[model samples]
Target: MRRRKDKHHANHERWLVSYADFITLLFAFFVVMYATSKADQRKQAEAAAAINSAFQSLGLFQSATPTKQLQGATDAGSAPAATQDETVTPMNVVMGDQMLASPQVQEDFERIKRHLEGLLSNQIARHVVALRIGREGLIISLREAGFFDSGSAVPHPSSLATLGQIAEALRTTPYDIRIEGHTDNVPIHTDLFDSNWELSTARATHLARIFIVGHQFAPARLSASGYAEYHPTASNETADGRAQNRRVDIIVLPRVTTPASPAVHVPAAKPAAIAAAIPAPTATAEATARPLP
Candidate 1:
């Protein structure tokens, strides 16, 4: 026999060492996955908390409980007086009282005015309607003859489309809208209405209903008032003046008091003057008011 080397033979079970290493590596991978999953959950919870905090700061909505911070997060103060060195004044509160009292809001109102003017250009040019920057943010004055019949609270059929357009334009705005009905000093007595007060109130209520029910405007943002003969843009001494007095005013109010600007007064023209200036259209049944017979 050849001389056999006495060197130690390699172990046949050495594959067990490789198998143990693989098991360890598999265990480590599962452990890492579990750790990563826990980290993801924590991050999601923190993100939700940050969103709630932001909403709270903006006064958007109420939360059920106070939000908790992440494990290592430090509280950061974003409020103006957190350090007590910043001077907060009463003017700040006053300014905050109105959401629309800012210069930016005023510019927005101007743009709206221009838009309205363009929309009602024909009526505006014919002097049947007037637009003014009043003590209120904006005033759109609609002549009675153009919208209603004499002593009637009902709007003319032709006026519906125009009123609908007006509602569409204003329903989306943030400003509060007040629809005011006014009548001439001349007393009105009809089966439907007792006096100017009743007539004006009915007219205002009618318009409000259209805005709320027809156009789906927010009831909270809309209001109706009847001034009767008390609040007139002109003296009700002449027929033209009376016609001017008999009008509806759509007032867009600012949320806060704005700086006063010079007001432009719109004068009322005489009925005869109006008729003479503008060609009279053919009399339509819709134009006639059902007056007391």
Candidate 2:
């Protein structure tokens, strides 16, 4: 008779191998997550440090020691105490809260205004030229009748002396000069100008050229622009109002300080080329004829 076969043993501990592997994988995942979190915190601290340095350089903060101590206190789980030396001035207050120009700039504008008024007394009295402190710094308005002929970009021969005097006065200033040309609501078309856009731009560019070529003004300090029947100073319904609207403005811009950066110089287009590129006005009749209240 054959001997009884040995009893088969069922193993219960085979599942322990799989359980150990799962536990190891879970630990490794948590370790990776902790390392990533620490790296993010490090990056955040670096960015904050950079920003603090910039603010300190701008004179917004009195001292850098306080910022470093504050950061350390924060990391140590403590509230940072405010101190007199750590006070930060508001940016608005530092930059003049209410006025656009500084005290010195305002004084300079006043001086220039007085000088021009004295020299242009006759023109000012005749309403051919006006000087005022406008929102855009000092505005010297030159009416079309005094500076240029009707529908002509060229200044009258008699006006050259006046323009020369004005240029001479401005030549001493350090501020930038912007020559702005304006027109009335009346539409225009001619051999030289196709629309008010061309006429206005041509007038402004011509004045700019005279300042640069004739009076030896710095080209970098001069800019020209044209507003065709838009940005009107008075109503277009009356002749006197229209006369005021048709004018060229010489604006003295306020000086501003900014952080240095790399500059890219681009060649400026000629006035004629710019005018040709500008699209014609497409205002409807209702909008164009609407009277100012």
Candidate with the greatest TM-score versus the true structure: 2
lDDT minimum window of 10 residues, candidate 2: 283-292
Kindly list the per-residue Cα lDDT of model 2 for residues 36-128, writing each as its tens digit. 999999888878767766754444322313455334435676654544422332221122233245666678889999999999999999999
TM-scores of the models, in the order given: 0.54, 0.56
RMSD of each: 20.4, 15.9
Question: What Cα-based lDDT does every candidate model obtain?
Answer: 0.67, 0.71
- Which lDDT tens digits does candidate 1 get at residues 1-293? 99988998889999999999999999999999999999999888988777755654433232323455576676466332232222111111112223324565577678888988889898888888898865545788889999898877767767876776677788667666778888899988666676777777667767776676666665656668777888888988889999899999988765422213322323433333322343222223122122332
Local lDDT at 112 for model 1: 88
